[model samples]
Target: MALFYKSNNAGVPIGWIAIMLALLASMGGFIFGYDTGQISDILLMEDFKLRFATCETPGVVASCDFTVVREGLIVALLSIGTLAGALIGAPTADYLGRKYAMIVECMVFIVGVIIQMTARHVWQQFAVGRLVSGLGVGALSAAVPMYQAETAPSQIRGSLTATYQLFITFDCISIGARDIPGAGSWQTVVGIGIVWPVIMIVGMMFMPESPRWLAKHDRIEEAAAAIAATRGIRKDEAMSHPVVSKEIEQIRNHVQYESKMKGGWLDCFSLKDKILYRTLLGMSLQSLQQLTGANYFFYYGASIFQSVGIEDSFITQIILGAVNFFCTFGGIYVMERFGRRRPLIIGGIWQACWLFVFAAAGTAVDPEQNDSIGKLMIVAACMFILGYAMTWAPGIWILIGETFPTRTRAKQGALSTASNWTWNFLLAFFTPFIVSAIQFRYGFVFAACNLLGAVVVYFFLYESSDLTLETVDQMYCDPECKPWNSRHWAPAGYESRHNLVEQTKAAEAHKPIVGGEESRREDVEKSGDEGRTERC
Candidate 1:
């Protein structure tokens, strides 16, 4: 059962199976992105209007479009549902395990889709269906990444976890291109997402469970098998494999540390352990990710383009979506190539500059009357998308996954994600009114947010790049290691882990043991300085 593999830049085994597992888990993002982009086009479809967009206000003569409240409710209800779901997702993921939690959420999303498909009667039906499905989307957002972050090797974990955002950007572009030029039953758009969750269920059936999750639940044998399967190690020697052995030790040690603290939700906010600081940091990052205004376009791109006088605005939207999608690959590269804060801080200033131009261009003329504003807005929008996709979109998710300790990751992740949805909901609900009142000036608000986000990031967000998650927990434990100077900080545990891994590598090649073989096992188990060495 030996499977040969090449090592990635991070020296982890590179196997197609592991890659596919990340891709499959990332289908949750596919569904989420579809829902975000799908409705933007659907809301503009004449068929949708004919069926559900009758004037809520008493108009004198003909039927009219949905009232502001109704439209806002339709779009924002999902976020509300997701808020609850993100909160609930933590316990569900913990109780059920990451793999099965995803399966269950996928099913829930499908059932919500069924309800959405049947909604020809009124807008409420469709909106309710969206709200119902959001529960799954929200939970999947938490669980899928948790699974990916847990199972992926540290070397490519950022790239692998960023696949979730990749699916998001990819599908948002794909949906905008596929459905933007068409007019049909909105149900078709709703139904298409069912395919994603279905794929998730099928693919996950064959995937390994998160080894960390198994370890957390005290399933050591199954955890080793999971490591073996994912890392391409032989199952017989998987437990004794140096990397695997060290990883298992770290997980056990961390879990025991957590148990000793006996922390719960309150612990997440308590200053005594500095958990409060991390909770706020994760929440702020998530909130700022939304405030960056990328979702503004995906959620309402058509309306924005139409306001700027592009008659058939969908093509312009498709171009922007394409840029957003392609630049996200650039984001994956940035995640691997640089530390976390620099890109985001630079992207913030970049987005702010473009958004300022966008607002100024819109304010300089009547966008409805002047043809030039169209090009300017598109240019500005594209620039904004480029910066955001490469930085905050993937960076925030990557940060949250690495920021919190394993003991509190699920709940704390939900808190930050809930912040994402809350801001998402606020912007979704209020943007129409805001855009109508100030028009392009609305860009200024997010531009300001982007700037503030940069400053906050400079002062607060810890750099976790290139460090393993276990190393991340230990790094955060140090009182002296603040965000400003964290790049130079490494926990002693990290050096020990690296030394052990190097020893394991030497052991693999039957290289001479530095202190002979008899004491190696004792050295590892007890950190005993006693003169002995043993086989890895």
Candidate 2:
């Protein structure tokens, strides 16, 4: 909280424009989180279970007779649409700027919500509705963070991006809505989730386009204006603002370099230039982020509570949601302070330990009779959520958002998000069966998965702290750079050259010119082009 209010050493507070971008973009995250959280509670509803009934076992209650696979399908349908949307959204985001892509996502979400709210007859309609809604969810997931990353300053980038997860934790409030009585309550939950997306669409109309995206397409004037607006400076004043000028120069340099490369989706897979290797690492990192098995807790936490003989599982969910929501603050703080890799390794270890405790407790005590063990299981689950919310949940997005170069960013974002959703689909699809078949022992599976994730983090993950996005790009572009070797590596003179660009701008700001403003503009543009060539 103090960090949000504090200014930089030069006494410049973060501009409201950058803050607004983060806030509006994060609404997409809230909507995504709401859908994720709501479904778990909906799944526990008797009405929702009966509406999607596929089995008819004699003497079984209608809800009780719902088959495991069918229930899993109902819960997992959203991820299927998410997988498709994330794959296609990259090309769409590149074609349409990030802001408009988000607007398009909102419109799709509205259509999906209408379909869901109006469903009268069958389970298929409900599933179709979830799939449609998921397409929008997937698109927003890919676009929003990319937009936020491009807009934020490097100093607070981790915390600002982590706000996406903070807004996600806001969905915990939706858990309380589950107690709404009557058969139509689930419909109400679905309808209510639309509020944040609507706000996001309207609010985005007033935000600036990403400066980096503008520069990528050679819209230099617009890019400068966007940077000016983001910095709360006049267009003329922007040329002398050291941080803004340096960033604009770096973006221009990167874009110029990209223009010389073969820019296409398939270019991302070129092994000759090591693009393929970098892409694979990003995709695998995302997969490991999901395969950490966090969503299993999100999707089936209610059932886990029930297995431990807690009668009012909704209340338990509320408690869990609160724990998740509050603990996320710890995550936001450590992300910038600890960098990205170490905290993840530490969190994975914590998650594995708590899950093992939960599993062992379940095995040792009969949940139906042992109140103390039931409480212990709940505590362990909350502890697991704490570890995850503070680490992988926020850290993965920050790392992924900053990983790829501008040329391959959208495609890599699409690929990375697609990998995440694919694993999400599989886990959501199979979790019920895993829990039912293994009972308490299912905890061992995720515990082992967390251990694997920790091992991966230790061996393969690299630290990406206090560096500009351009420098990070250059690091990856180097032929000698590998994932494990990144910690010790430094690209030559990029920082000093960046400072020189800023110093030159500040010096020129004080000079008198015969050609006036237009002449200076031409000189700046020419200098930018030459700098691009020299840097390349």
lDDT of 2 at 41: 72
Query: Per-residue lDDT for 165 in model 1?
Result: 93
Candidate 2, residues 6-65, lDDT tens digits: the string is 322123325678788888999988988888877767766665655556536533336254
lDDT (Cα) of model 1: 0.76
lDDT string for model 1 (54-122, tens) is 655543224658777888888888888888888889989888999999999999889888988888757
RMSD values for the candidates in order, in angstroms, are 4.6, 5.6
Misplaced by over 4 Å in model 2 are: 1-13, 46-65, 173-184, 307-309, 479-490, 494-536
Give the residue spans of candidate 1 off by over 4 A. Answer: 1-10, 55-64, 172-184, 303-309, 493-536
Return the clash pairs for model 2, or none.
none
lDDT of the candidates, in the order given: 0.76, 0.75
TM-scores of all predicted structures? 0.88, 0.86
Q: Choose the strongest candidate by TM-score.
A: 1
